[model samples]
Target: MCSHIFNERNRSFSGREVIMINTDAEGIVVDRPNRFLCIVNITKPVTMESEMVHVHDPGRLEDILYPGNRVLLKRAAEGKRKTKWDLIAGDIMGEWVLVNSSWHRKISEWVIQNKIIPFLNGIDTVIPEKKFGDSRLDFLLMEKEKSIWVEVKGCTLARGSVALFPDAPTIRGRRHLEELIKARNEGHEAVVLILVFRQEAESFSANKVIDPDFALTFSKAIDAGVKVFPLCFSYEENTIHFRSLLPVFQKS
Candidate 1:
């Protein structure tokens, strides 16, 4: 049952515990020049100077990525890329919320590989970024003769007791939902995995006020037999811990 997955910070798969992510450094937010770049003051490992860091996630992040907030960083090898560090998570209300989209694929793979969600237990192989009907879905899971088309979405916005996705309006998100419905109609199992990084969220829903089209499409996809999983996790002490499987609610 899914109830056992809600009991612990880390679970063992055949006696092997999973550490989803690890960071080599910490930083304080100096400024955000754009959606993909942030000026950070490296506070750990003897680097007191300001440097340009890569922000992987494309959300507006207006609520969390503000100046003076403490954040976690994953350092890149010297001279490997334009930015030396990548913004991993941000401190929000004394809790760390994973904001990096680069880690979304890895997190989704871990959940599927470990069979944390009972319905997805037997997924054998995860193929990512496959083009189907002009939409590049995040993953295509294969198990025996079963083909599952999956789209992964990272959600960081939490309000009161609910978690809403697409902190900004996303035409692309709406398109993904439409494609998932198409996949379902084509005799394939389709799923949308909403990874809610906020631990306090008791339920998940599509943000209708921000983008009503996406919200309506989400309900449409639900009616088309496409499954949605709003899995919650907490980022604390530099490790991601499973919190719970949130109930999906259509916000009216």
Candidate 2:
């Protein structure tokens, strides 16, 4: 199991300027004047696009960073270009912080250490590298005893008693449902786990209007023996705990 700790630092953000930093626990500065920087809380874990650090202004990057905040860089892979920069963690003005990668790492570690390992009952297994499958599979879990493939999708967009997925149309998401059906046919226990990070959602369902194909595939997968589990996350200051499993509403 992997673990992470947060370290606070300060820096300057001049609007669109980007800074590069080492992504380790004890964050280190790598470069300056790159693209964009946004404040993040290192104590909390985040994943996917939610981990981005937004630049508020072009000339104020240097004036708004501070300790206790995580930073994100834009154009992280490519070299410096207009309005692009490597994310360097720092404290710029006051109280303004950037999002850090610690949240995602911590959540991943928790899943392995507390959920997956224990559920497998001492069986040895490997965490497969995450990839963009027919849709996008969050994880591919494998073991000698029983083959288990899981797709993890985050449900952050919710309103009142209703919880929705794929706020936007996702062809890739539709493909993932198809893959789940394929995995089930191959005799593996294929499951879809929707991680609802927020506390408001009480139930979950696929948005038919956004992508009807996804809804159809999901219904077929369920009928074909693929288990769908939507679990809620209980959030504390810096830690996230899995709560009781929620029910999935399959309406086609």
Candidate 3:
């Protein structure tokens, strides 16, 4: 078994640290810097003495920033882009920070290789285009030779045993469910994977009051044979581990 100990002030880790456990131990890392815009996880807010500015990186802003995200920062160093600050190394800062462009790619790569790949053998899956049908579906998997269209929803919202999806209402999410339902009718399996970042939620459900249309679409999809799987995992300082699969709670 591998373990990771955080050295917060130095912004580094101990030796042979397990960046991601359980899921894909081989692909996770610690202390590596990535360049991508990230939203601060406002669910776990951090305080800063100085004000930080948000800038646009035209290339990948859409993939990085979310409404309630907070970002990590490094003092402007010599020879770096004037608008950018170095992102912090770990996920547990006082505030949830958006990873910048460079960091975003690293996180995405880590998730795909470490988190997503190891789970593939258990199911037949395909790598769909990042952006599809006005919404990006993470992986299109086929189980029992049946196609399963999945939209990977990353969950950062957690309050003890409760886990919430899309802290803000998502129009794209509604569309994704609609698409999944259509795929189910076409004789394929359609599903959603709520990838919970923290090991807090024991069950998952759509934030219906937050977005009724999403709730309606989710109901229709499940009724039409679209499966919803909520997975929770733990990230100890730097490493990530798969906990247990949680059942999805459908809202009436």
Which one is best on lDDT?
A: 1
Which ranges in model 1 have alpha carbons more than 4 Å from their true place? 1-17
lDDT of each model, Cα atoms only? 0.83, 0.50, 0.49
Task: State the lDDT of candidate 1 residue by residue for 1-252, as single tens digits.
Answer: 112112123332332333557797888888999999999888887676688889999898987888888888888767858898888899888899999988888788888887777778888788999998989999898889999999999999988988998799999999999999999999999988888988788878889888888989988998898888888888877677766677787744
How close is every model to the real structure, measured as TM-score?
0.88, 0.56, 0.58
The worst-scoring run of ten residues by lDDT in candidate 2 lies at 5-14
Please list the residue runs of candidate 2 whose C-alpha ends up more than 4 Å from where it truly belongs after superposition. Answer: 1-109, 116-123, 130-136
Q: For candidate 2, write residues 1-252 as lDDT tens digits.
A: 322111111111112111222342222233233334443333323333323343433322332243334443433445554333334333332221333332433444445445432343343564644553445465666667687776766654455654567655677666887888888888877767666544555667776766677778777988888776665554432234555456676563
Score residue 164 of candidate 2 by CA lDDT: 67
Identify the runs in model 3 with alpha carbons over 4 angstroms from their true place: 1-83, 86-125, 130-136, 142-145
